[model samples]
Target: MHTPTTTPSPVPPTNPAALLRAMFDAAVAAAQPARCLPPHLPAAPAKGRLIVIGAGKASAEMAQVAEAHYRRQGVAVEGLVITRYGHGAPCEHVEIVEASHPVPDNAGLVAAQRLRKRVTGLSADDVVVALISGGGSALLVAPDEGLTLDDKQAVHRALLASGAGIGEMNLVRRHLSALKGGRLAALCHPATVHTLLISDVPGDDPIDIASGPTVADPTTCADALATLARYRIALPDAVMARLRSGAAESVKPGDVRLAGHTCTTVAAPRASLEAAAEVARAAGITPWVLGDDLEGEARAMGTTLAGLARQTARHGHPFAAPCVLLSGGESTVTLPTDAAAAANLGRGGRNVEFLLSLGVALNSEPGVWALAADTDGIDGLEPIAGAVLHPDTLVRAWAAGLNPRTCLDRHDGHGFFQAIGDSVVTGPTLTNVNDFRAILITARP
Candidate 1:
């Protein structure tokens, strides 16, 4: 969708890489806590203690922002937040704890326990302010009763490799944890709960962000069990038994304990994409936002997008060139099932995988440039954000004696991009709005 405006046009950047990076920076900046948090914060309760608790890649930065906001108003606050290691921001009133992400670890387990204890015995006069974002399900690990930390870790590992989408994976996570699925909100019962979220999941559903630790869940243990069965993910016998017996059921919607709880989505993928569109408009490019809730196999999505880009570049069917196609959503990467394929799998996150596949499909189509990156600055588990593609990307790879198809087959996007020095690295951005993809097409002269 075009952002209607009457502002005078500025000179557009001629360099494709510079233009792409500027769009990405705008998207990430729009979702930062300092920019999105204040409007969603509730006023300090007159007769209550403000207790802050949270987890995710952005939770620490969120906590820091919340603390500063309240402190400026002279309100006393106390709490703890757990974020991915290296994603923490300094906070004085709220304690910031670093933990593992995309996978659970002992540190996250300990922090989860502390977080649970903090909310215990909170009176109706107390207020629980929860800062939730993506990656929280793993960063805030508290295995359910009768399940050990090791058991949770084992199930998590299986799920990561299962090719399941975020919705299904979070369903399983919510049922298997002590802190997720409104269980944390239940702990803060009697106290008013306020959940502020930066959504990285499709649909921007509060129930799926960080597996909805503070929001009521409509999914059941049965739903989680079905997801596991569909993905053929084997869990510990104890976990299976709990699910079958519904002993692992999450707090459902309409639960009396959650009566006064409120949830707010402060930032989302759509908003970030809109910000990028504005940047594109200023650059004299027609911006088409393809939607912010796309999901499927990453490589397949990449190939499909490549076709669209080609259509626009060659035929100008979608819109006249000098146009950029933008989209945001989480895409699944099904790890290889074959032993040989698995053994040779390369290092990369889903964004790079998508870009690599797109590059191969385009086969160096002239006047087309693209970038695919995760908004949080880290794609999957890699240190890099994503990669960029130019018309000569494949040509450069071939010149280096690298086979793009072979690399795609082995899931070696990181290797391929790195070999050609095209990987986009931004370290930790401390915010999560999910993936960002943009394809720029210039009119053939």
Candidate 2:
């Protein structure tokens, strides 16, 4: 009698770096406009001129995809979109303007003026499609009636360094802007407005995305002033007066102009995190999705996750080993107070900072591997997406004469990863769904 044939088991990924990269890639791919936009596109207006206007890191790509979709259906489209510098995508009919991001600039101010003029005289038969995403607030910058671009820039810098959340910051931006906080939709009134959003905020609230340029605002000028006071951000007298006098109020909810406008979120941080979980499952690993709305200090979040990873690996309290824990959202970094100390801090983005902190906390824990990256492929202001950490990360750093704790204290995650050649650089992915983090814990053999 012949012996029964045996099938060999497939080999698991021995290199944690490769596995983590695959997970990050899956997350980014899931948020791409090509994959998410088509399904949510509203039918072309039955009998109106289609004018597209948008701003954000993903606005250019969103516009390009929309143009391609309408073109395939023989529908003509025209309009303009503003995106962060170096994030532009080619679109035949829609003009793509590049401007500074995380900071307001003259280029964006000019673009906002042009975009407002485009929608000003539209009739009831005309349709306006607003493609909004993260970074749109800074990229669509047009200061309020009494404020200058310089004044806005000063306030932006202060808000950024104050450890303020995106919601608080956007509230200030909405009131100080000429086109944001539903004013653009008001300008396009009588024209059917369809807004598509790629949310990067914690709650995916349309009102918070790009400061809700095309959606009604529930926040008021007083709220904006309160945010400034909370953050200790000072503004010019005229700018402050505008808020105090309620002259800079945003278009509030129940505004007649926003009655028929439609807003839809085509892609979001939760969807991207779920996509990464799928990749983990396919690899024969259990997936634990921590959350898509996590927010707080970058380093503290990293340390907290490390503790969970340890618990999962040792006690299996929340999850068993052979699992990957995933989370997505934006985390902030508070710069050092001393100028000398701040100057000494090395270059690194928030994602790398999170990863670096995690590595330190893990302290060479065996069989634990992780990755932290921004879905947009740029962490903070750095060129790299983020980085990966393995059990041997700290050992390798020590061998290289680098101290992980020292690097973390200096806020030099980029430097630490670069020294070890473990930085994950993907250039620009043309999308923004916020940060992605994954920790993989393997079962003991």
Candidate 3:
């Protein structure tokens, strides 16, 4: 592993929560576009214009970084990037458009149309720098012909509530989007398109990140239909007809249009976890990275990890105390099947749900504390990133008349944490490497 270039200020060992947050901050800092994107930027074309185009929670910052990097070398840059409403950064050359996320809106629809138009008529000498990352799938929305913006919005809402994984979600998205599934890259055909990605999906698959706008897609419309059927997600008849007729087919591999295109994953979940591990090691605490691509139902993940924490805390087996267990990847939450239960659902993201479930399973087990959050600074639809859980988490909940198990049942992890003053809120981190989770076990047995 490469050494972390900077060390965070040491948080006293007595304060595990502080240390956990410190580690999270380090992970975010390590993945910043300014630090990761510059090294992989493509060289300017000697005789042609340079155009920047992208969409994601991190794309704005990515464009800003790319602009600064090229401007330093005396290259003129111009283009557009779409991001979540609150995730935009200042960019002089690249136009920053803020749009809805997790769900498509009219603003996104118009921006996507502009993006598709922007890439047309490019020549061989032109260079297109595509900044892609998590959340791009929704931010860069161009509904397939015959599908309305409202129709696309409904599809997203169904997929979100359907308990589908990111890859599955993107599969559906790609077929429904005119610009996704490598169609955008096809439009930039003949130009040397270079894509920089900060992956927020499991396996770091370029095809799944932002639905691979600038990369060739191997999946077909039939595959997208299968995913929707598996998840029991239904779409409008127009969308169904488009997929059935193969009218929504994406750009495939070996297509000459993408012949000279390139892609690079500048940052990913594993690297961020390793950065946190470095901080933990410097603080005299052993850090164990369980995996960078864990996926499952949110609450179940919490229960399973709680068992590991208990074993380490009680028996010191597999791993000794005074160690932190770190993991990354996307965890899903399957909303309640019952309408009444869904109606009573509280606001929270998957990260807090995992932490709350973990806390309940621990039952205030001494010397075990944890934090789970999204590195992009938004957990689910909430502005809050995630939350923290300490040995006293349950104790505080009880004292405050908050029932952790009940909150878990109602999908109210955010409310539970916020009520107990443990919710971790970091607005607009400007980078995404997926979820960050850490379980710290002190040496006291």
Instruction: Give the TM-score of each candidate.
Output: 0.97, 0.95, 0.96
User: 135-210, model 2: which lDDT tens digit per residue?
Assistant: 9989988888878999888878777777778888899888988889999999999999999999999989998899
* Cα lDDT computed for each candidate against the true fold: 0.90, 0.87, 0.90
lDDT for position 82 in model 1: 95
What tens-digit string does per-residue lDDT give for candidate 3 at 1-445?
Answer: 2333444342337889999999999999999999999999999999988999999999999999999999999999999999999999998989999999989788998999998888999999999999999999989888888888888898888888888988999988998888999999999988989999999999999999999998888898899999988987778888889889988888889999999788999999988998899889888787888888999899999999999999998999777778889999998998876788889999889999899999999999998999999999999898999999989889888999988898999899889999989989999999999999999998545
CA lDDT, candidate 1, residue 188? 91
Ranking by TM-score: 1, 3, 2
User: How many backbone overlaps does candidate 3 show?
Assistant: 0
> Model 2 misses residue 370 by how many Å?
1.0
Residue pairs with backbone overlap in model 2: none
Task: Give the better candidate number (1 or 2) by TM-score.
Answer: 1
Which scores better on lDDT, 1 or 3?
Answer: 3
In candidate 1, what residue range of length 10 has the lowest lDDT sum?
3-12
- Most accurate candidate by lDDT: 3
State each candidate's clash count. Answer: 0, 0, 0
